[model samples]
Target: MVNVGLGHAELSSTHSNGRVQEERRNEGVVTSWCIAKPSTDDESLNHNIDYSCRQKGVDCRPIQPGGSCFNPDSIISHASFAMNLFYKSAGKNYWNCHFNGTGLIVTQNPSWGTCKYPA
Candidate 1:
């Protein structure tokens, strides 16, 4: 069991293949992760985006709304001025996958993209 603070806890169990199963959390409630799979259309779109990011050498993880590209060093790798410029050119939809303050909020649309900073 891993405590995430404020009464939030995550419990993991190993599968036969040595893969860890993660419990899905929704507003503190637990649910089946597979049940949360996106619709076919949305799934394809996300897959395309994920492929694009990967082609650029960006390590990204798929989330409910969209995906997040992260640098290996996380915070340290986020100090690139060129990256900032790239994100700016990528428009308001592109987000920094580092700082929690503003990167990409996954709950707003949950269809295409979401704002990093909630208003």
Candidate 2:
């Protein structure tokens, strides 16, 4: 989700079932944050991601087979998502994006093709 203005309404577009739908509403204020990792696999990153998922009880079902985030599924992809969730839950602060060297913070939205990141 993107905030159009300060205390202003924003339009959200959702693509589902071959149709594009849009709506206006105020859900929550969003700040720009992106957690990215290298293509190379790292054990520490995996460990942090796993511990985060279990400890926080994050709902990762959306990344499962037949789920919304299932496409382009990979360890790195899912880990980035989980890390982002952790940051968002913690109030979208710079510190929240720090996952003990597991991620890098970027100003970009980090939303992939058809994969909407929490704003």
Candidate 3:
């Protein structure tokens, strides 16, 4: 068991195939990780995600006009990037993944085209 107080913690148990079985906080045996998935286009949600990033000081340059992930031009896409940035950079945890309901954590990498979602 691993314990982190307002910090990052990754207690991983892997299988023979090098796949992690769990890497997150415990909730009566239910566990989950902060993985980036697809995002939604809800304006309110997107605003929340972007607001969270700016408030948390997450580097949002990549999603700017001439940035790496600006081509998408979609709120969902932008939010996805921002959400993942916080989720991974700020410490992969429920709070980071919880982008006021804009974040959708999944097992697969959501990187596409030139936008790379950090793993």
Best by TM-score: 2
- List the candidates' TM-scores in order: 0.19, 0.63, 0.59
Give me the displacement of residue 42 in model 1, in angstroms: 16
What is the C-alpha lDDT profile of model 1 across 19-79, one tens digit per residue?
A: 2344446699443110111222333433334433444433334322243313122221122
What digit string (tens of lDDT, one per residue) describes model 3 on residues 17-117? Answer: 22233333446543333433333446764675657577565787887899977756766566666777777776666677865554555544445556666
Stretches of candidate 3 off by over 4 Å are 1-41, 55-57
Candidate 2, 1-119: lDDT as tens digits:
44221011112354433332333244663355435455435576576567556645466666578766555566666666667777766777787766765566554455555566675
Clashes of 1: 0
Please list all clashing residue pairs in model 1, or write none if there are none.
none
lDDT of candidate 2?
0.55
- Per-residue lDDT value at 105 in model 3: 56
lDDT of 3: 0.55
lDDT of 1: 0.26
Candidate 2 clashing pairs?
Answer: none
Full ranking by TM-score: 2, 3, 1
